[model samples]
Target: MSTDLLQARDLTIRGEGVTIAPFSCSLGPGDRLTLLGETGSGKSLIAQAIMGTLPKGLCAQGRLVIDGEAFDAADSTSRRALWGRRLALLPQEPWHALDPTMRAVSQVAESHRHVAGRDRRAAFQAAWSDLTELGLAEAGSKLPGELSGGMAQRVAFAAASAGGAPIVIADEPTKGLDAPRRDAVVELLARTPEAAGALLTITHDIDVARRLGGEVVILRQGQVVERGPAQQVLTDPQSEYGQRLLAAEPSRWPLPKPLGERQAPVISASGLAKTRGGRELFRDLSLTIVPGEIVGVVGPSGCGKSTLGDMLLGVTRADNGEIDRAQGHTLGFQKLYQDPPAAFSPHWRLSRLLDDLVRRHRLDRAAIPPLMARLGLDENLLGRRPGEISGGELQRFAILRVLLLEPCFLFADEPTSRLDPITQRQTLELLVELARERHCGVMLVSHDPALIERICDKRISLEATPSVAKRELDPVMA
Candidate 1:
């Protein structure tokens, strides 16, 4: 009998004549392992290779074993059967992972159908119970667009866990979540592997690894730099790469200054109302953002967080609200979307993009290099296009572009949603520093309650207004 549940021996991956040399790791039953690395360090690539989802040009050469059975990458039928039944994956991008057209419940049910070979009714019934267990009671009827980042992730977890896969691979599972939600998701992931089998989690969040209590494997440039027990590697690492990663953890970042008693509001809104597709998203909403203050907006998914961000940035006009902007108050808003690649022009280099923004805004060119350095970006990266950069780098660059504008008010829409925990912490620290030095009022829109608690000076919850017929439901609800 094999001692290992999943084993990879001399596993090598090659792309474009360059080789990602053989690196091996093994997992025992109920054992969890985390693959740690920077954005472009082939963490996801390894996960993809395991799932047989590598890009067309890339080829894999190695030995893979599951429960003493030899695994062949060349066999498509065998690979498919093993993929979701015995080997499951919780992908990085939940938005893309889920079909937007289908209802959330239906998608989860479909996973059950495909993996467990359950009938349609049985699958649908299973989805509800699974969703409820995942803390999503009414998630069955909602589409992916209607869910927040956190909610979508929970739904994905439900789908993956429902399959009873012995080996599960999760990539950056808690990327954009707030501390509490991050904890919840991490706990769920940690517990899932124990109940079913072993787990392989790819993450930049050290906290997640620590909480999961697993072995740690540090990857750099498509190779393993270090592998050891999680506690030793995180708390007292011998490798420089491990040290750098530990340093990058979010806990190390300094907290923002608290908001003192204020006499005047820096930005005020009254009767703020926005409508789309004959639906009233927000109505008569009032809020104040003070200078040197971080106001966090939180609500359920599809509650108009992004729309409100647009209104704050003057990107979208409010039909009914009066927005009072302070005199000479320029808004240097850096909106970080969930898909960073979509925000930038594919044809333009990072240098060209920054240069164009600076020229258009007529900002100081001399400040660009220093600012980029402060954001931990190398001057060499300026020549690379968005496609050439990792998600984390692209996110930092996007924010850097906004920093160059140097506005008084900064409107960030889920800015750290796509970033790893390490980068997330750094980005938050950078934002706080910018706010303090520049004395800017920042309005942050996020679904993570923990992030709001950690970073914001004030928090506001948006409630949907009930219809006239449903007035008894409560006015305080909105």
Candidate 2:
């Protein structure tokens, strides 16, 4: 008798000009497997194939077996019956996966009661325990919108695993989390295989694969370039692509150039404070940003990092603060969102959106081609909608959209959290170079402390309590 928890033979995905080559793998009891790749490399496609949730126009062709039940990957609905009972998937973006109107605990409890076949009271208690274990005991009553990116991710994980599924698939589980929270998530993922279940994770973070301590298969352009044990492959990779990817980690990046002489201020904020869900995010925060400078912000998840950016851009009202923008530059203030897909319309093609922006602003259409080339964006990508492209591509397009307006102040809220390491390094380099060339003031927010230390000319560290400290990046580190 075969005791494999999950198996896929010749699993292949095909769409228009793109094809994920035939791949095969299996997971047995107490086994862990991670698919390591960059955005658009077909990592998510393979997970979606097993889950039977491939996007429209893409089709999977392979044989999939989960918990001794076999199905055809081509049939998208074949695996729906196993969802949350024998199979559970934690999606890449928790905000989109979770229901906006439902409270966190209720969502998990519903899964437990319905899928796990537990009674109402028992399910509620189990859900509570899960949240408590994940350090989200107080967040149970909060809605998805009220939680931060990392908190919402934990709630989604709790809901997904409440059914006690033996086969677990997590996609980009630690994409936008701080070091401690990311480690916590890795531990939770490890618990699945530790309890005799099987774990299949799809992530672009090398550290995630290292922590998971699983078998790794590296992909590039939808083809496998390397496969081996985590320890051997991660520490000493045999493939060239894998080496490049590992070298792109922010900690390994070269130090950015030292800050030049100060210039006129672009934006200034004084005594900023915000309270959400009875938690004080920060208080008495004041800072000034000069043109051609990059300011980095670091803090724990849910510490109002995004809120602070919104207040500076005038998107949200501050509880106690006054913001000043350089006169005559009001139209130049813009923002780059954390989630690129959420900021765009799913129904419209990229060309349509770009045309709308250009028309609305009366900007030059001729400049689009040169900018697209510089961003390394292909011309064919313009024909696809926001959902049709990868997160990395959509983010570069977002940068293109903002740069066209010749902005003097840009607030980027965790802009590269979802990007793969190589693409992330490239994107930040371009952003910094452009900012310096145009003399734009950039308020850069990231969860990685090493990233901030390497690139920012100034730094702002926010705390959970009522305090915010702003200072210059130490020249010694450079």
Winning model by TM-score: 2
TM-score of each predicted structure versus truth: 0.74, 0.94
Q: Which number leads on lDDT?
A: 2
lDDT of 2 by residue, 182-216 (tens): 89989999999999999999887888999998799
The digit string of per-residue lDDT tens for model 1 on 1-478 reads 7777788888787764435668788988889999887666677767777787765556777878865678765332456667778888898767657888998898899988988889999999999988877667766788877776667877877787778888888987887665666787888787756774888998877778898877998887677889899988889989887887777554454454656666466678887888765667777778877667787777655456778877876778999978987776544444556556557888888888878877887889998888888887767667666765556777788788777777677787778765655667767877877876777788877766566667777777664442421111111112
- After superposing candidate 1 on the true structure, give the runs of residues whose Cα lies further than 4 Å from its correct spot: 13-22, 56-61, 71-81, 220-225, 240-244, 255-266, 271-311, 314-321, 325-334, 339-390, 400-408, 418-422, 432-441, 445-478
lDDT of 1 at 100: 83
Candidate 1's displacement at residue 34, Å, is 1.4
Candidate 2 backbone collisions, by pair: none
TM-score of 2: 0.94
Scored against the true structure, residue 65 in model 1 reaches a CA lDDT of 82
Error of 2 at 411 (Å): 1.1
445: Cα error in model 2, Å: 0.9
Error of 1 at 128 (Å): 1.6
Q: What CA RMSD would you report for each candidate?
A: 6.2, 2.1
